[model samples]
Target: MRLLVIEDEAPMRTALVETLKAEGYRVLAAEDGISGLELACTEPFDLALLDVMMPGLDGFALCRELRKRGKTMPVLMLTAKGQVDDRVEGLDSGADDYLVKPFSLRELLARVRALLRRKEREHALGNELSIGDAVIDFGRNMLHRNHKDQPISSKEAGMLRLLASHPGETVSREKFLDVVWGYNAYPSTRTVDNFIAALRTKLEKDPSKPVHLITVRGVGYRLEP
Candidate 1:
């Protein structure tokens, strides 16, 4: 699973990153709300850990903006204010859950697991996805073609999941950068192109004339199946 932590405190953010990494999750982080909002909107994270107070675009505003943009990812708001009104406000603003400051790491992890489990259950009934001869087992993160398992890198698996989620819909270059790379720090679009090439090589019968993963010139890429 992938998670994004939007905390302004360096120590807290680092600790959260390390903890989540230890739990086998791919984590991306930002120091301020602006960057956090950007990452949340562009990335395909399973959940977001947003600190309520920050330099720009506080958590409430960020949550509202994400909802406005049609993002449905689970958002857990972290706040120093533990009062009833603050919790109500956070939920009213669109946070799926709220975590008060000085929380136990174990509690946080439990909440994270619960939220991700809910998301998985929701998406479990979606249509089966296929690219070329490969069938993607999302729940298992295993790809099978002709009853044979194929080895795929974590990055490649992430990319495939994103593309498969929106089959036949063009995913923008910026979206790929944020989600697949886990941050918006890449200096060029070449990275996306390279990954697309690699994906085609693995999932297409003819990489030169891909039928499933198609590129839209001057735009981005799309998957047909």
Candidate 2:
């Protein structure tokens, strides 16, 4: 998954980025709220992590502006202040979740998972995926393309859904394993390539020279449609 982290502290921001990257997320970060807001508004991130205290625009204002602009990406507020009113303020400002400083990494990871899963479920209401000439009936595990409809595995459907969520952006192989296949799953990184190859055959006009499912040199794969 892609995430935006807006934090002022150098050390804390670095730590958050490294930690989330290790967990297989593509992250964009900014040290000030204005820069953060700009990046958040421009990028295709699945979530945002905002530090509550910052110079100028602050987390609350950034989040409120994001909501005002109709960006429904989930926001998680981070702060050292752990009082009742502070929590209420975070929520009132449009943050979906809040995290206190000096938090256990385990718990923080859990909250991140929960929020993303909730977002995933909300998107689940849509049972079809349309990319280029291909249409996937995820509800029925079928892929229709080139005037033919063929059966596909649940894992393949999940992989396509995840990749489709972020179009025209490279999704890392690590993210593929972590989100679609789960972190602890036994598949190695090569599994992503194999899946992509199979998917190309199903969705692309030429599997040997794929167009829609293009590999991003050293990073991962990107969907053009």
Candidate 3:
């Protein structure tokens, strides 16, 4: 999973980036709110850690702007202020959770895990994933499109689930192999390409020129939904 850390304190920012990385997450750090906003708007992230106190744009304003721009990623507000009104303001500004500064690393890690788990649960609540005119029903292993129901294999469904979960993020072939095919179960990356082709044939209006499931040249594929 990917996480964005927006904190002005150099030492705290580095510690956050390193800690999240050590937990096996891809981390991006910004020293200020403007840079952090740019990163948050440009790409998709699983979660964000925002420091409430900043020089120009405070964390509350940043969180509000993120919500205004339709970024739905969970945000954890970090601040030294543990007062009631400050916490209320953070939540009112669209933060999902709040953490006071000088917090234990163990507690921070626990909060991160809890937020990520909640996000996964939110994604799982919907078994039907829609891409353009096609709707994939994972529960029944069927694709509903062209006014008809088409059968899709378990592997195909798994690939779609992974891609859909990440949305615009590029999912590498190695990641697909590990998640869908159980690593050595698929001997070559070519197997992934073939499965993608099959999915396009089934889901795309014109499989020769797909729009939803896109290939990223040397990289893997991304679901445009």
Task: Please list the residue runs of candidate 1 whose C-alpha ends up more than 4 Å from where it truly belongs after superposition.
Answer: 125-225
Candidate 2 whole-model C-alpha lDDT, 0 to 1:
0.82
For candidate 1, give the lDDT of residue 218: 85
On residues 53-162, what C-alpha lDDT tens digit does candidate 1 reach at each position? Answer: 89878999988888778777878888898776777677667676788889999989988887786567547635345776888665455678777877665456657777
- The superposed Cα distance between candidate 1 and the true structure at residue 73, in angstroms, equals 0.7
The C-alpha lDDT values of all candidates are 0.79, 0.82, 0.85
Q: Which residue pairs overlap in candidate 2's backbone? A: none
Clashes of each: 0, 0, 0
Deviation of model 3 at 67, angstroms:
0.3
Residue 179 miss distance in model 3 (angstroms): 28
Best by TM-score: 3
Better of 1 and 2 by TM-score: 2
* TM-score, per-candidate, Cα-based: 0.56, 0.56, 0.57
Per lDDT, the best of the predicted structures is 3
- Candidate achieving higher lDDT, 1 or 3: 3
